[model samples]
Target chain A: VPGDSLSYPEDLCPPDNFNMVSTWIYRSSFPKKKNFSFLKKLGLKSILTLILEDYPDQNMKFLKENNVTLFQFGIAGNKEPFVQIPDDKISAALAVLLDRRNHPILIHCNKGKHRTGCLIGCLRKLQQWSHTSIFDEYRRFSHPKSRSMDQQFIELFDGREAWKVIDPKWI
Target chain B: VPGDSLSYPEDLCPPDNFNMVSTWIYRSSFPKKKNFSFLKKLGLKSILTLILEDYPDQNMKFLKENNVTLFQFGIAGNKEPFVQIPDDKISAALAVLLDRRNHPILIHCNKGKHRTGCLIGCLRKLQQWSHTSIFDEYRRFSHPKSRSMDQQFIELFDGREAWKVIDPKWI
Candidate 1:
């Protein structure tokens, strides 16, 4: 009954790489104007974006109208020896993700490949999923452009640190 | 809090290609004994399998012990001009999927690629997802082994037929 009342006269165009991460968590590439109707169907309470750039005006308007809060934990994509994703930022994002108040949230980055994948991978760790399963999911979304640096980041992430901030009841 | 009480003494190994399809629907490759502990954490009410072979004794025992109902709609894999997946079986599976009583159901096949992908693709159509978005998801799980025949089956499979049998409230 969640989405039954919503009228769908035509097909919904979900953002690229869109997929459900868990019970109320979703992941996708950066959403566009065309994807707004589809996003509305999710009845999202919040959107956690991993992009560093300022949000576009159109998206801001949509969020405002829908009363969906935005939480941005910007981290640059892991780019080899020069740039590395900050662990603290990811941990903070995990803390936000662990709260049920933010249920029905959508997590996204530019391509939803590296930054978002890394966050979901870390979340999978908290869920006690084996590294093999976590990496399998990571690579599934990353596909042709999977990054080894991102995988290493997930491997090295400390779930204990995440545990410190998250509510046990929410986990 | 849905999974908060599930104890995770050790890392859990989910079946290959396991993912949430919708609110209460999950898709994965055939479950193995090693993945039992992880499946237990899902609190599944039932499992719907698409393989033509008889259910394995071990799996049957797991379902019985866990009180998970099994719904098998056996259909041959779409193997080009020779073997075609029957439309009626997929339609029947969709009918099961659209019912809320079968909530938290796991759908699987041998590889969780072709036949499973085809079935999920049709479900996406019922949800009013665009064909481009549908095929993107199909290819993501199928990956290197994506089959055009299965994609065609999804494209040609009529959602109107599925709508006939499904409850309006569940949609």
Candidate 2:
């Protein structure tokens, strides 16, 4: 199947803002029906969602069919002064990400922008990325709606808590 | 080095506009001396460059010391109205990308924007990505300076030609 002509008729539509975050780690907006076939190709072992709502039946069905685990580290969108994504939730999420057994994982929120960006920014911090580089990556996915507060959250997130929970073999 | 506390003091500074294009394929701006240590972590086996210039001495030294091969497919920038990236060069570059032996490869140009974007766009075509998904990724990396001409080039490029030269196992 590898050298077959690239004239395959099937066209894959990845969810909005989808991109690989690193080895076995992907980030994107929530997957819709159309994105399911595309998602199948990823052979995902797990999905870590930041959305606060109950999981949709269809998505749950898809995961059950594919034998994929769900890790919900729900947090509200950072809405400036009043609302903030809890630091403990992101720390717990990082614990999931650092474990290789749950990898080939996708991280998502509604738009795959602010919340996803913040989580990824913190993950980059764990990977030892410079703040400037992490923010640049943050702004790339978030684009016009990039939030200063999310950047601040990433800047302030401490990786020490995540370190305590991670599997040594996976990092 | 896995799961050592995430308190590593050395911050990695990835080159401007750096990202993983796929599992082993990375895209970035022309790497500077400072980005060398960051690149080292990738354990790159080769670098496939699209810049139409001589490789820098420092980069050459890094490659030599690391035993990484260099594949230069120098093509002019896709400036509007006149200059265009030749179709054959991109096809040739695709052949390099399709070969797993050349993998854990880094693909770059001066800014890692236009030329690299077009190249990745075509690779996505081979992967059967929808145009919307492809362009969204293109614009994400190019940002304020995305070009219609480059997108056009990607749309028009044929992937069949690349299939002829690919190693079946790599794709």
Candidate 3:
């Protein structure tokens, strides 16, 4: 039914590429106030922010007012070849995400690419997803600008450590 | 960058509404052979089919040859209020889904709506997702024909039993 003919909402900062991961978790780009309102309407409980830089006070204030917790993981430069995402940060963020109470959680970065993509790639690794599938999903977002180091990170992510501590119910 | 202006691929049945849920799992409508090839290209290792009826021999054969496993859960009717999805079946399908070996999996129905939406809804419940977010994702797929029963089922889904048994490493 979702042919190429239908039009989407025109609101700026509308949750970009928003999709559900097992009903509780969501993947999308950064949310503006309007998008935050939309998230509130959707009953979002927490946000896993991957913006390497820039954290607006107003947005943080709005999130607090809305009762939405923010989990910030700032790793600069989505495309700077040397800016590698730290494994411990990813592990820590995922630890917060492990609690079922964090359901309806959103994982996002500035453009919902690069950093977000890498995080998802690692998650896929936890899920035991193949490298090809991981890369395809990454390319779907980053497209012409997808970086190789991020893919390498995902390809080599070892989830055994994360698994030993994370709740098993998520799989 | 992913404004509404960009165009998706031209391949027919190329995983409509296709997106990575956790790097491993993908969500989309049913696929044709061409789509199958596309999926194969992406290294899809398995499929979680939710179509109630109509499993063509060609598709099955193709999957077999391509080495992609198929997990079929046929629930009759998409919008027929009389045709309700069985809870046990959902539990069973989820059981298959729980295995990390099933990563790079695709969950699909004819239109990727109704039944698929219900399953996703229940999964959200497992993740402790809010009804608002669950329904929003459902509507994104079902659009004009989004059914009330499906929404009702999701709103009332009891994930306790399923949660008690499924693996947690997946989240």
Candidate 4:
């Protein structure tokens, strides 16, 4: 029943990434236990969190109870000069995502705006998508406020280096 | 350049109807003159105004200058037992929409909530879409408050009778 395809409840704010290349990969804001019923429909086996803050115990317990794995990756800071996203963590998260066992994964942050956006921006780079398209997708979701630093970071990211570290066969 | 296709500005809330069968049929809230540049991108030939209150002079003047036709169809009141939407006006509006010449049309009320939503609900019925799907679309856009009368109105509408009055070659 948990894995059955059903309409996502309105409260969940379910993932609807415009550039999702696979149904197995999802991007969303931080999900609560109330969202679990609807999220269960995604059949997610892993969660890649980029909170850069304290992880709630309830969420950790929920994931364990649901038999889902947790992969926490956070970048310290809010804006540029303050923001500090390490390449190694992103590569590690990508490695987790690449593992076939972690199919149907969700990536999330506080509001799924900046940090999550950067990770997705890097993923788009790895997929060989154009810069214009990547920035468009990022800005569309993060409208009213898009950080130029995130754009700059994405543009400068060496996805080849990340892939080299992760050694993902799919890419 | 006024009619040329351009990227819709992020500030202007562009039309995003869930049940749009044709790119020509656009639905949105009342637009300010500032929205004209972005709205122009739609290449709209006409606007269907359903505001119960007086239509602003600026909007009318803007429409005239842009060479776009206006079809004002207002329904009185807010909730049930008060709101009175005339059947004939709906017939007329449908007639206007049926004319391919008046395509790339936009339908709007104050917030594009009740009246515009009702018309869309009725259109969904004419298109033979499911009630569940119709309500889902309505509630998604009109979240926090969705009236039952609107749903009832759409459910009871005789599309055949409306079609009989407007009998265009298009479905």
Candidate 5:
């Protein structure tokens, strides 16, 4: 059960089927959300994002109009600059969003599933939430059809001792 | 006819047996002797290199000695950062190897092939060398192990409108 504090974006409507989950997240494992019509519908006017190459142009126009500050960081998985960002950058994203009173941030991948879920999942983990709580938050909102998108990340959690710090919900 | 300035790295073994010329380069391309061992002999007391990933301890000790710098910078084919080195950083490496100029400066990737050759070739182009001389430089040094490699690079040359700007032998 999600606490009253848990919030979901009002615009994340079911796209007639669960398969839509795959369409949004595909290219890379960083937070590169695109197609902001949903954000516009939900009245989200500002955002910050990190994305890989060929980010959606429509989203660029959206970010520009919304006056959001998009910080593009490149990641080549298992390659140079391979070191993941410190927790500080993570905190920074949330701090700006929260200070502005949760201006409806949209963290996403091309599919808006794995990496997006990962970031959100980690936030829940930090807050000591239960697996039920985090999944509930996910189910309550986006209702991802594709569950296996995070297979590698889940495997990493087991291998890297990241589970020790993973939010309780993931356990 | 090869020029008097014809020089190539000794121990010019390609990373693999398949790394011959022509098949991997363009029909218009020429290659000279350059190989991986050239890097080991650079005599850096400290070097951060990723090449050690492929070689076992019996083969390499620079890593254990903490004498290699292996940060990612070059472009990965799939827009990933497999081995990334920014342009400015390579210039830095060039500076370290040369003062007024007498030092062995060798660079290579698998095969002494495409990527390595391309960058070196760019140095020649910068010198405003003629395409005739440039192609001559490549042919004199490498026999094009496979016609396809030569075609690969020659294709790149054929397409470049400003051929002189990217010749690969001047340096």
Candidate 6:
């Protein structure tokens, strides 16, 4: 159910008036091991790395660090999860790994918008996050929730350095 | 990751299968519960009841005696990780679950296969099932894998069902 489009947008980005116990850790810029130190400050632990093949080598370095446990999924870094997720869900999933205590986590995709948003949303749902708060993140990000959401969102996955000769439009 | 399609047939069907452990349970069918009783006689503990959600009023008799957990997940059932999983991957999933010690869990979707397969595969991967065994289940069960072992196999998804009926396809 990760590919959700509409509910996810609203779920990831809800109106400010919503009441929820959610937090966002923007580890998009921090390659794998680099941010563990900062995450330690936030009291976060573990990481669910939504890796695409083209992700920079820097991120891998962090993964090699001692404290991080990886939940790696090769969804072609270019492609993102189906939709945004609620914060409470994140709370619940974190609760799963968080119960481990003070292990700072970072959920990252190459660019860290769609896949990370979707994973966090799913995690929020797992934690029983209110639907309203999930939508708040989407509203704040202000990414288009468009007719072409799938294809447009797919653009975040554009990681290839070389085009395959079989690319349809190129033909 | 439930919709994963693999290139190998063995991925779907593992050889020399082991019994699955049941950690989760659901309420579905009476006869199935009887089957659970039969398994129990063989030293298996079925933790979940399998109740056919399509027919809600049904009470699984064994559940009253054994106290199995009950749950449902729309048509997709328990396959939150994925709506549909590959055939062979799913088969391996079953094997891994069975081999687990006293962890015989019951999982189902609205019907049972899609989510069951997805969750099973996830459990298998999480449990450290071998690379060969994992591929075996994917080949044995997944329809998408039957076509081509392409990235699209992983990308295949059933569109959002609960979204507003804006497009004819949404309905």
Leading candidate by TM-score: 2
Comparing 3 with 5 on DockQ, the higher-scoring candidate is 3
Report the lDDT tens digits of candidate 6 across residue range B87-128.
444433343334434243444433232343444434334333
Report, for every candidate in turn, its global Cα lDDT versus the true structure.
0.91, 0.90, 0.69, 0.67, 0.34, 0.35
Tens-place lDDT per residue, model 1, A138-159, is: 9999989899999999999988
Given candidate 4, what's the lDDT at residue A43?
75
Candidate 5 is graded, for docking, as incorrect
Error of 4 at B12 (Å): 5.2
Alpha-carbon shift of residue A69 in model 4 (angstroms):
34
TM-score of 5: 0.29
What does fnat come to for each candidate? 0.65, 0.77, 0.06, 0.00, 0.00, 0.03
Ten contiguous residues minimizing lDDT sum, candidate 2 chain B: B1-10
DockQ score for model 5, please? 0.01
Q: Rank the candidates by lDDT, best first.
A: 1, 2, 3, 4, 6, 5
lDDT per residue for candidate 3 within B12-119, as digits (tens), equals 234555654545767777776656655775577888988767679988897888888889888875446466677778877776675688877888887777777788
DockQ of each: 0.53, 0.68, 0.06, 0.03, 0.01, 0.03
Stretches of model 6 off by over 4 angstroms after superposition: A1-45, A54-56, A76-102, A142-171, B1-171
Q: Residue by residue across B9-127, what tens digits does model 2's lDDT show?
A: 67899999999989999999999998999999999999999988899899999999999999999998888788988888888899899788898999999999999999999999888
Docking class of 1: medium
Q: TM-score of every model?
A: 0.95, 0.96, 0.53, 0.49, 0.29, 0.28
Tens-digit lDDT string for candidate 5 (A1-171): 111111333223211111111111111122224323334443444443444566567656666787655544322222124444334444444344333333434444444444455545444443333344355334322333435333323223321133323233312
Docking class of 6: incorrect
Give me the runs in candidate 2 sitting further than 4 Å from their true place: A1-5, B1-8
TM-score of 1: 0.95
Over A72-146, each residue of candidate 2 has an lDDT whose tens digit, in order, gives: 988989997789888888988998987889989999999999999999999998888999999999999988998
lDDT of 1 by residue, B33-111 (tens): 9999999999999999999899999999999999999999998889878998888888889989878898899999999
